[model samples]
Target chain A: MADLPERVEIAEEGPREGFQIEPGPIPTADKVALIDALSATGLRHIQVCSFVNPKLVPGWADAEAVAAGFSPRGGVRYAALWFNENGLKRALAFRDRLSITGSVSLSASDAFSVKNLNRDHAANLDAMRRMTAVHKAAGVPVTRVGVMAAFGCNYQGDILPEQVVRTVADGLAVAQEAGETIADVSLADTMGWATPTRIERGVGAVRERWPHLRIGLHLHDTRGLAVANAHAGLRLGVDRFDSTVGGLGGCPFAGQKGAAGNICTEELVLLCEEMGVRTGVDLDALIEVGRMAERIVGHALPSELLRAGSLDAFRRKQAA
Target chain B: MADLPERVEIAEEGPREGFQIEPGPIPTADKVALIDALSATGLRHIQVCSFVNPKLVPGWADAEAVAAGFSPRGGVRYAALWFNENGLKRALAFRDRLSITGSVSLSASDAFSVKNLNRDHAANLDAMRRMTAVHKAAGVPVTRVGVMAAFGCNYQGDILPEQVVRTVADGLAVAQEAGETIADVSLADTMGWATPTRIERGVGAVRERWPHLRIGLHLHDTRGLAVANAHAGLRLGVDRFDSTVGGLGGCPFAGQKGAAGNICTEELVLLCEEMGVRTGVDLDALIEVGRMAERIVGHALPSELLRAGSLDAFRRKQAA
Candidate 1:
């Protein structure tokens, strides 16, 4: 790869992460249209869908159909999230036009891992390692590995920095042994509990331990600190972020009652642009996508930019 | 008055500061119920309604009726905001149970003042002084004198710190001549263009100029930095804040089309509680009030706590 410019990549998550938490199934055609619209907004990396069991999460039941309909554009990467080897096989079917990615969540707290993913810490790590080996042999790129709940877990509360550092080292070691070079390593504030001070410490520790690994952030707006936390990460020189259009998606462990949404795409873009960081996404286009997502969900989504529109919207109203 | 605890007083603005922004008029009964609900949340100060010309702001046409409906309880001080002598006369009718407060807005740029208040900077200051004299002779306890647009005005662009300082000195000098001690001086970021560095500079300059005058903050969330700016003010030892419940208000100058709402009450409460500052407001009750406000508005309000409900809401869901 040529020297990557110092640009912040906003990894759009409307398909996999945003859809998973939705109560009812969104049709495959609508999902395709949503992804197609989002891709046209110049988002370089888009997580199209996840390869989980249809019975477990009905929202992504048509993941394969949705993936098949995606038209790859230049310099853009379409990816799907998978759990075990079966899911990995399903994702590998789109290898010609897309990059297949696998995720294993390691919670700093065991209770959260078991409660959320229905697996303890050791079992989850072991499954991830096996999947890594299968993907390596198939020559499909495993673009990312994320450590969810690396900050304080909702169930366990106050996850130590030492635990997160140890988990990153263990996951990196497993991936290396399987001959899979990790494209990116992300730390998620699974419950939106990480502060700027904690983020600085966590990101710093990860960088010191694995100098070659790229770091990204996956944040929730549970405490309304997601944007501030993302800005803090940027200040520390970490570029990539995971956001859902209209700030859709919530934790399953948090269940139906949880108010936490993904950090909003339009708001994130506005923040980046104001700070002089290049996100390569248009605010107006993202707002249009956000409104569509709101319609699909049958409820108003949590994005402020969509409701407020843009400064141009205000200017136009004045002109009228 | 007995020595009040050196506590930070955040006055809720759902009724007055918030309501005036709505383009269409909300029902008087709904307005009364909203204030009644907010009053029950244990906020020490609540700006209940504004006594502005009904022609200028149709939403506040029933200010006197709204004030009459409010029955003050222990420690809660219901207040009404007045812009000039006629508004103060309307405010004085509720003097038995409500405190009357006055506002003067200075534009760092002269154009904003003309556009927003229909006067230049000097004329606005003159109007404020005249209102102060009328307020003093009536023996109404003036809890606060607010200076709006203390930060940069949207029309003028950047406001000089020296302009802010001079405005404060002038307001203070008038209050002294009237023989009524100004309880506190509030600086508002009417547009949410303020950064932490600017906040620190503004606060530091104001403190150095008038060390004994109590200072407060009234911030907007136009750029998603209201909470961060509030935190900066708190770090500078500012104890009072003016916020609307559910973050209901926006600047008319931000224009009608794309204005952002005020900072949500739940987010502010969470930030303050986490920092160990006492806001003396009940979080659960405040969330309930936010929901009520949403119902009244016929659409969802911008409150984060209302959508997320409370931590208690999550705990209950987990229990189920």
Candidate 2:
């Protein structure tokens, strides 16, 4: 009980994740509206856009437009995800507008690294080294180490705690060689294969090995256990999480199976607030944004709270 | 860790919950087919149908047809829900095939009792007393006491632990006065207002008061925290749960927001199996049944596992 954190930081990734996955030629103006609305929801960290090749991810082909259009709120850090120098250079164009910290992202499963990144774990470390050097030369701080498929993988089966430890160790070693001071390490359940037990073991291993570094969880609700997994993280004293409003980025609940988006930001905020943990988020306002995201996407996203509403909303009604 | 149950029972309530809520005149054959298919998936307890007034729940108008239609498998207990003596008499007609034990049902929230049950707590207790005597007269055992809105209520706001204990005690008193030996108590998150912390405190308080009685959770995902609340129950070693296949009773994901179904049966199975708790359920078979339910309902249900496939299914694919 004492392990629960006093407050947690929920980083919003709806725009970056949702636009990248939706198979729509969504108007750039709507994308900008989403970012602007999320900004007003008291979310401090919002990933605004993904700077990827337009030819491959046509949904986000107008990443530059979305990057340039939204009104950024003060005290909120707007981020852009880029895989290579090309994307980073494009992001550098908006250096004054975006909070551009670089992350040394690696995959815990060698098979997932080979399948997703087209590189093995060793090769991926080399790539990270090069990317770290690029960020250092460009005066961008690379202070967060991220591990994809940290819980389990589609290509590789169940991931062990020792495997998670070795992956984070590799990322930290890379940072050491690059003279980068890593402030936090984030674990991504890229395949939606995490259970509460796995979260306890995986996060426990990382924390035991690196007690000084802050731990973050990036969970996917591929199998409807994201909320449970988040509760497990909260119980373990993890205070940082990355989520998407309306569970954006995964296949819409009605469209397909097997791919679920990130944990709905409003749901996570509701869970935290109900447990008396300060989330710094107005859950009702966030739920409204979730509804707005659903409207923009032209589908019902996988957020139950967006439909039923926050408990407090009902409480207020009852009080009235 | 020691508190986790080694094995748990997940009772399927899809056909009853889903049909009652779905606007469709879902075919009687489809309801029977769902029940039959779920029996094959190793779920021991299946709520086959609801014997309510046809005008009130037209969806379950053919409860008798479903009750008599499905082939009841050995080792599986088919159950039916009813409210008044008429509904109980309807269920009694199929007593040869259905599990005929009765439950003394009450609501913890006075506001919910008045709004939902159309009676105050004191009045409702009198109604339950009459119902218990009716069950006793019919040679039926009233062994379970169910408290709805046991966690919180939309009309009444938060529910205190002591309130839950009082509600259960009232139900138990009604049963004892009628010579009923209650064996278990179920605390329902009737309005989807329960959190993990509440589950712990509520269930914990009940266990402290009645250590001999088995505790069951009947949770709703109306607010998307059902799985987390279930986990909280598992942590407290509460071994029984009531869930719906494909999240049957709740509103469809894309159709509406707040009125989501029960904690998904497959998701609960996945959680239990992943945590090394025995559920005796074939998860892949259950997922297939969930898909079939979607096909019958002609829409997507709120189960992410129904789409993402189970971890074992992927494991098999990876192995193959």
For all candidates, the clash counts are 0, 9
lDDT of 2 at B207: 97
Chain B: TM-scores of all predictions:
0.90, 0.97
Off by over 4 Å in 2: A251-258, B251-258
DockQ of 2: 0.65
**Model 2 DockQ class:** medium
Provide fnat values for all models in the order shown: 0.14, 0.82
Among the numbered candidates, top lDDT falls to 2
What DockQ does each prediction reach against the true complex? 0.22, 0.65
Question: What is the Cα root-mean-square deviation between model 2 and the actual structure?
Answer: 2.1
Q: A116-232, model 2: which lDDT tens digit per residue?
A: 778999999999999999999999989999999898887787889999899999999998899999999999998888999999999999999889999999999999999999999
lDDT of 2: 0.90
Clashing pairs in 2: A257-B307, A258-B307, A258-B308, A307-B257, A307-B258, A308-B257, A308-B258, B250-B260, B250-B261
